[model samples]
Target: MGLFEDLSRFLETRLDEFLKANPHLELWGLEDQLRGQEQDAIRLLGDLKRREKQLEDSILATAQDIQRWHSRIQQAQAANRIDLVKAAQEREATLLRQGNQYWGQLKGVKDQIMQTRTLQKDIHDRRRELKAKIAETQAQRTAQRTTTSWDTGWAKTSFDGFGRDPMDPLEESFQRWETEQELEELKRTMGK
Candidate 1:
């Protein structure tokens, strides 16, 4: 167990360092987290809806049972059966209480459904925002890479006009001939 914990800690530390080193990965991680949260909220909403339906069914069944017991109570009274009347009235009261409890549960489930829906929406909004940021970050990184490459290319190719002359062999020959002609003209002028 100690070894496992140490390994887990090491892995976590490495992951943290890796994520810090790559910020774009962190944005993607956030987006994944938001997606997971949205999925959880959707699942909760489904469960809450199921619970609400069950509570509604329970409330309806309890109401019917209450009505049936109420009818029995009236019938017992009409028949002048006091003991049965009391029992039927108690049953009816119990059913009413049960129905109220179901209603309360139904209300709570409905509230939870609303809250889960809001949570889902919030998660979706965060994911959208993160996606936009990720897109913007990608664009900026692309532009930065392009500019860096351009600068590197220029740096590698630049001769700064003072390094080596780029003239062809023929151009060099012509330049040499022109210099000789100028020297000859200067020599002739000096002799005269």
Candidate 2:
């Protein structure tokens, strides 16, 4: 048998063993386990996407606050309000710091989302490849079985050329010689 067929058979045997060991449980338990893992991965991806969006929103809001603070500082200076000017300056500094922090957090969250997405894609691709390989293995095994059956039938019928009657020793030797010559002729005709 081909490697894939052997592996598929092995997996089938293991599955049977597992089923036998867990006769009281339904087969849905295995399906549930796989579904749980898939759901967890999807949930993780959703969380990452939400976190990324929140981070981006925070960064944009921080940037807008920085701009507002700068405009307020300029207005206070133009109106010659010393106290307001100082306050605006402090607020601008605070907003700038916040904007920097938010930008850093946004970048980090984006990186994390990208990494998670890459991992998910890799896992999905591997699963598809494995499924395709299993299907290919099955096809090969089916073809091999058909070919084997054909060969067996041919072997069983091929000896009909030999007569059923008992022969003298000399005649047996001559028959063997003729059979060898015919085999050689067939080999040559077949370019073997």
Q: For every model shown, what is its TM-score relative to the native structure?
A: 0.75, 0.51
Count: clashes, candidate 2: 0
How much lDDT does candidate 2 score? Answer: 0.72
Model 1, 15-57: lDDT tens digits are 9999998889999999998899899999888888888888988
Scored against the true structure, residue 51 in model 1 reaches a CA lDDT of: 88
Q: Considering every candidate listed, which one attains the maximal TM-score?
A: 1
Candidate 2: where are CA atoms >4 Å away? Answer: 1-38, 133-192
- Writing each residue's lDDT as its tens digit, candidate 2 over 1-192 gives 699999999999998898677542323444355455656667788997888788778878878888898898889889999899999899889888888887788788778778777766766665566556656656776677768856654222222345433333445577899999999999999995
